[model samples]
Target: MNIELVPERQYQVFNSVAGRHHHHQPIWQNIKNLLKSCFGTQSDSRLLNRDGSLIDINRLRQNINDKQQSYKKRHITWPYLLNIYSPSMTNSDKKIYQNRARIRYNRLKRTWQERVSQGDSFYVTLADTILKDVRRTDRHIKFFKKKKQILFNIMMTYSVYHPNPGYSQGMTDMLTPIVYVFIDESMSYFAFCSLMNRYMSSLFDQDQIEINRRIRLFNLILHSIDNELWNKINVNEENYLYVYRWLLLDCKREFYRFNHVLRVLELVWINSISPFVISQSITNYRSLFTIFICISILQEDRQIIFSYSNDEDLHKYFFSSSSSSRSHRSTKRILQQAQINYSNYILSQK
Candidate 1:
């Protein structure tokens, strides 16, 4: 019957044990207080009676276990609505679903065919370009041809799905690297769709509002970043045409490696952490990243660029569709430098 009270300082020991055992502090504190009140003194054993006798520790443990089990059982079942509403469709429902699915399938097929029929010349050009890249002795020649068809199908499907910005010229170039990376037709299609929806949709706008907005933004960003180079280019509505294609196709035609082109596109898409507080509206235009990237690319050739005496030279140098093989820096190097330069510029703005 020798019962001792838990000292005030000994609460730390109880807390430490509770922490290690993951026991709730309130429960453990309540148990301690009850023992103290009942016994009128501290006890070496946590479970005890008022008469200084040991209580059934097993019963207390069982009570807590039962409460937890009951709580979990009540709260962790399938959602009420799901339980009430069976997902299993009736025969009639299944028939209706199949009919709707069939209708959608027919519509999509019809739309895809219509797009293909309209863009026959573009498809032919695409096929020729695809075949030109594939060497006859290459192991994946058949796969390459298959991929070309998949790419064309993806473009047509995208055109059908998105009629507002229905298929544009550079779309095939944009989708080329996407199809190469995501080999599965459906995966490639969706990825291409996502790219278009998120970034390149503006380029295909019928009214050219998005296109003009982007061009203006690009000029704004370039001017802000480098007024000297911006002035040298002296870009106008007519002269910025090459840049339109570059931005629209994500510089796919410029870069050598398809993977490198895709890497740059994704980097632009991610819009990584920047030092400056960009406005919400400004951030909405994902193409700003490419604009900054263009600035970076231009900065690499700043010496040669500044030396250009006229707009035509500046245009040919910076915005030309020609291969960038002559460019000294690698795509990765240019991208890294772009990020660094952007971060520094933002920091300066702050």
Candidate 2:
């Protein structure tokens, strides 16, 4: 069977099973209600405000307090910093407790060291690279150092937890935005893992099967959309390596703001719309939507790309273009163009 058919088959099986399990409706409905309540029915205008000014600290604090109260009332197990910081040891018992804790910490440290030694060298190199680029001069030096440490810890913990795909070069880039948003290392780690498993698991596959599959799918889509441009590039699947980082990191490095990346990711996560409308009924094509997004991005640069006469020029263009942050489009525009292109492509197929 074609590898591409697997996702479609899985979707079909899932839908069939879901149809039979009508009893699950209430559970799903409850989950939807919970999410709506947690996130609110309408988007918060304060967060969405694009004005170039400092955030209203008082409003932010109140929003956080409201969320905490809601979570507490609903008995949601939110991790509190106090739980990690507060010690139960009394003045008299402090010595004994300290000794026990030191012993436990030593054992864990030794185990962690052993695991780190056994981890992939490539991941270690990537982790080190991530740490080097983790901070910016705009932030306080000490605060930036602390954030780098938190990021390092999160990457190490995730690598240990997922030993098979231990770590990949782009994994750190993927986690950076998540860690920045969550702030708390533990929460960020959990969110990173969830995202990896849900949307980015393939990118880390040892066999490179999933990444290659997506690349091929992307090539086909590009060809279908504009064979002239596709042929002009004069590259095969291997030459399309330029797109690997984009897909793997989900354009995290491309976008200027982390919030913009988050917005794009949220839409990608939804995966309700299909790139090819003709094939929409056959499969949701959820996994291929990112490729469609890439196509949309490429569309923005099509004219510039067409100007290149040779592969070297094109390769250089791609390499130098990373810092061309001005070219990055708004999340809304990217999403709209992607949808429009996908719909047109689907119609063309018909």
Candidate 3:
């Protein structure tokens, strides 16, 4: 193998598997967040404008708004997980799929094949939604590939609807799973765009104010938990660059390990709509506290982290540890303990 040559086939194989697995957590979390945000007392109390006007957070949740609910139920069944996979499941399955990309690609190919065979013209609307590269830029062309045309179209529609945001690099990653699930490309685009409008304010911002706000929130959490760690990292000075992308994109780039990524995503999704319990004191904070809870979970593994300085070692530990019974149990326990103390300290002042 040429050392410098791009492993296009291997890349696609890994991405397909990773994408499919990653898809589940976000969908489940989004649904849970939608429901909890609507029904949960904590979140309902917090969703108000600066003027104290109520925000209809529930409007963002999923429901049987139309015929789509029935359709959603059909595709989201459990058995479909096994049914979707190729027959030749093996240890080297990813390699086989490199020769022929499995699952999602097969699904996409099948859908495309059916549309072509039926002579369906439904794809035209989807094509129109794709934004023209008016500048005809090479970067745009490279970023938006043929495989991602549908994703691009949907994101383009999202951009138009949220004219302030227009388009951004991270938007495609957020929307891809939505496009894959809806099957009816056009409807999927609209739904995903709508869903995004609720939570994606930072990416489309002129000043990236929301990103800054979240970073502040994280800093507050770090101060509350481990003042020493906070000072050591010097977040204001940009020492913890690793977490910058994670917080900004909400962990999309860092979470190649499917299960752990899904776990974190699910936690956020469930918490999203619930009103953030702001601290009553000047010391109070928001979502970043939970991020500290996550970091504390990793604290137990800090020795292992230090032991293996390479990226692969860290990846292996994060992935392997997430699936281990003891580690998962420990993470849950730490989260519960931290939340109780943090909540008491915050709520007592009010």
Best by TM-score: 2
- Mind giving the per-residue lDDT tens digits that candidate 2 earns over 117-164? 789676566556545545532132243455777777667667766877
**Tens digits of per-residue lDDT for model 1, 1-350:** 58688897797887788788865777868979887655554322333343323355343333322222222221111111112112344335535644664465456656547654687776456444444433221223244555655665566666656767776666766666555554545545655666666566777888887777767777787888788877777654566676676666655555655446656655554452232245534544246567677777777778887787776776566555434533455776677777787667667756
- Sliding window of 10 residues with minimal summed lDDT for model 3: 77-86
Tens digits of lDDT, candidate 3, 232-348? 445235434445455655554333333333334334443454354454423223244445554555454445556764555554554452324233334445445545655664565
Report lDDT (CA) for all predictions. Answer: 0.57, 0.58, 0.46
TM-score of each: 0.56, 0.58, 0.46
Regions of candidate 1 where Cα sits further than 4 Å from its true position: 1-146, 235-237, 272-282, 324-327, 345-350
Q: Which runs of model 2 end up more than 4 angstroms from their true locations? A: 1-146, 235-238, 272-286, 325-331, 344-350
Of 1 and 3, the candidate ranking higher by TM-score: 1
Candidate 2 clashing pairs? none
Residue 3 in model 2: lDDT: 34
Q: Whole-model lDDT, candidate 1?
A: 0.57
* Candidate 1 vs candidate 3, lDDT winner: 1
